[model samples]
Target: MIFSSQHLLFSSLLLTGTIMSISSTSWFMAWMGLELNLMSFVPLITSKTNQYPSEAALKYFLVQALGSALIILSAPLMMDMDIFSPMLLMALLLKLGAAPFHSWFPSIMEGLNWPQCILLMTIQKIAPIFLISHLVTQTSIPEFVTFSSILSALVGSLGGLNQTSLRKILAFSSINHLSWMLIAMLLSDYSWLIYFFFYSIISASIVIFFNLQQYFFFSQLFSNPLTSFTKSFMSSFALLSLGGLPPFSGFIPKWIIIEAMAYNHMFLPLLVLIFSALITLYYYLRIAVLSLLLMTTKTKLLSPFPAQFFASYLTPSFLFFNMFGLLVPSFFLFF
Candidate 1:
């Protein structure tokens, strides 16, 4: 995890590109930012230690290139022809890995390191989702949007049921959350923003936990000695919160969205999302229960004192901030 100068430079460029893409006023500038982000991430994904990185880099490049091409190809028609709207929207959906377009997501996540996975799931989504949200406001395609959202929710829930890989499970989880975000996009005003903000916090926390444990598989969690009772409890709580179970901070954003959907009278879509969310919670609980039940006392995992200190602080600090909403529910009422 020691960063070379090249890594630092590329990381900076990655952030710059993400910021530029989201802030750009013109399509061409946004496209440039996307390209910059992609190129920078490619170099970062290449590892001297593994071939999976190379294969993942290639697959990521090809899919992203196709999306960028579609966006560029359809940009000219967006102003005049409403027919091209779906094309542009599809391009963004592909970038976001929303199902039935989510085939590449798990494979790609499986290939990358934890840091890369974090960027892939979190920051990398900013440009495409932001653009897609803007387009949803401008164009009138309620049915198509709803269908895509439902399909993503269904795929995300059903797909993760058989996966043993932690990364793949998280990938599907991200897809399911994307469904919530998209629903918030369509019906609620700023609820999507609130949802996405909290989503990132919860995701970053879980990813950090995995990174600290060096866990990539479900079975690995049971074998890791660092997973004490306290650690397991906090970890389970984090996953439940991310699953949007009631009484957790994750539910706050969902609550905002539900209230907004009720106000908008989107009962059917709301029901579908709620059902899919329950399915998603099943897998989260499966993993969480295993964490609590499986305990090994041998200390095989080694960490520097600094890392231990950080992890100790990170677990409680993250849980406290996330559950802060539970203790003071009124703070988020404005959203």
Candidate 2:
């Protein structure tokens, strides 16, 4: 009971910090909010009594602290020259865990439990990315932003192919998505927010499913005791949606972005983005295919009814969101 209460308190503080940072009028207030969020989250990173959490918390602190310091230092320079813009941008990029600065991300994720991972991937990103969106408006978005974003997408696509650890795969996937979010930030305010929101929801649904099953590895996804055709189908469907396949909700954001890029005649970047999406799709399909193969047993089993029920309920939640933009195109139209 005490543990539960601690979680509730810290989680509330986490949300409060995120809201404060995004809504802040000044960089100092945003930094303060981010610090509040970082301090609150470090404690929660260790729900299990383990060394991994301690190590992860330490690494998280160092990176966030450095980023915070850079942001602070950049403020004083805001008056004299635009040189500090790159420093400020780099700091936020580090916080976002984009490639080249992303080394800390997968390692920290490896040490965390699913709930902590969810917060790390979803909520933790809100402030820094929103801050980036704001900063770019003050200075011309750097050419390096586009170059690094491309590198991030390619690195994320290629890095995850050999990873068996689900956390690491998701980490790489997050990096890839960060590339899209960065590009979207260049395009429009609504684009990045839409991408981030959909990314957060889709990621949470998938991670929560894994959390319920206590899966930590790709192989374990196929090793579920309650394996069924429906479960396998939904799992694969969710992954495909995540891979941004057409007709699914995940495809909506990608579709919009691609169209926008084409309109701007960004053909080369568009090609690279498409290539990365295809590579990512290969792995998502690999997981789904492997899981489906395990469901071929002729003998019917019903021992894990609770797991089955959870999967059934969760799958539709994912499907609804995946199909949301398709059913209501106006949602994307407005954005």
Candidate 3:
């Protein structure tokens, strides 16, 4: 938890597990890698001092174990029987926390610290999603994934509408983004990867900002009078970027995916995705507007502390990227 030796060991194993799963040539090896990944993550999430983490660890273990069991069970049968492909797909979707199977995600996120939450949202998803991409090429899997994507978009957008906890909001946001990535996966091999790369950067930046401020809820953003105008503005901008607002880098990948979807004539899913995106942007705007528009009398220009200093310096780079990063793709395209 403190980046000590034990943490280092487990973290290394965690990465090893993901690499193994993604790179493995056989189902058995992949399953073993997933198990190793699961085992390594449990220790990282568990803590003696905190009860919530322990409870979270248990829930995470159980859910992941069930998914792993399904994977192992279905993997052997997949070659001989077509039905097993859906079973295997379901297992991966469960692991990815794609909706309908996503009930466990928000609760687990609530119990994690920001660092662990970042891992859960980003790195932990890589292997399962890669496996899903592989599986999508099989018969009947696309329809299933399509339905799950639509459901994930709807559930993720609707579920976050009333949440106050920052973690829960992020959890739902991850789910919504997963819907987009799922659609991207069906469209092309690399579109989801592109979307995920941008998503990870934006999500990590937002969470890191929250971690720096020790903010766990919306109320804290408003209550902390020492919050600076620069910090507030950056935070709002990051949230908007995450919500996929135009002119921000976050919207770039979504725009690419939208273009591809249009070319494919997938109008219905496109409409649903766009509408759900609007809902997601609404909540993000809610947070950003309240934090940016409401004036605080005791706002500080800068805080004389090491943490604030680090954050203050780091924020400008992120702000610059969010503001101008949309130009990057075009720069490559035209020139």
Candidate with maximal lDDT:
3
lDDT of 2 by residue, 1-335 (tens): 43598888998999999999999998889989999999899988864568998899999999999988998999778779987888888888988898789999999999998988999999999999888888766655546678778988998899899999999999999998888888887788888888888899988988887887788998788777765666566667778878898888888899889988888887887888889989988998899888877775665444243354564666777767766656786667777
Using TM-score as the measure, which candidate wins?
3
Output the worst ten-in-a-row residue range by lDDT, candidate 1: 296-305
Q: Tell me the tens digit of each residue's lDDT in model 3 across 141-252.
A: 9999999999999999999999999999999999999999999999998899999998998999999989989999989999886777778888999999999999898999
Return the candidate ranking by TM-score, descending. Answer: 3, 1, 2
Model 1, stretches more than 4 Å misplaced? 296-311, 329-335
Model 1: which residue pairs collide? none
lDDT of 1 at 304: 28
Task: For candidate 2, list the clashing residue pairs, or say none.
Answer: 249-322
TM-score of every model versus the real structure: 0.91, 0.91, 0.94
Model 3 is weakest, by summed lDDT over 10 consecutive residues, at 296-305
Q: Between 1 and 3, whose lDDT is larger?
A: 3
Which ranges of candidate 2 are over 4 A from the true structure?
A: 1-3, 300-315, 323-335
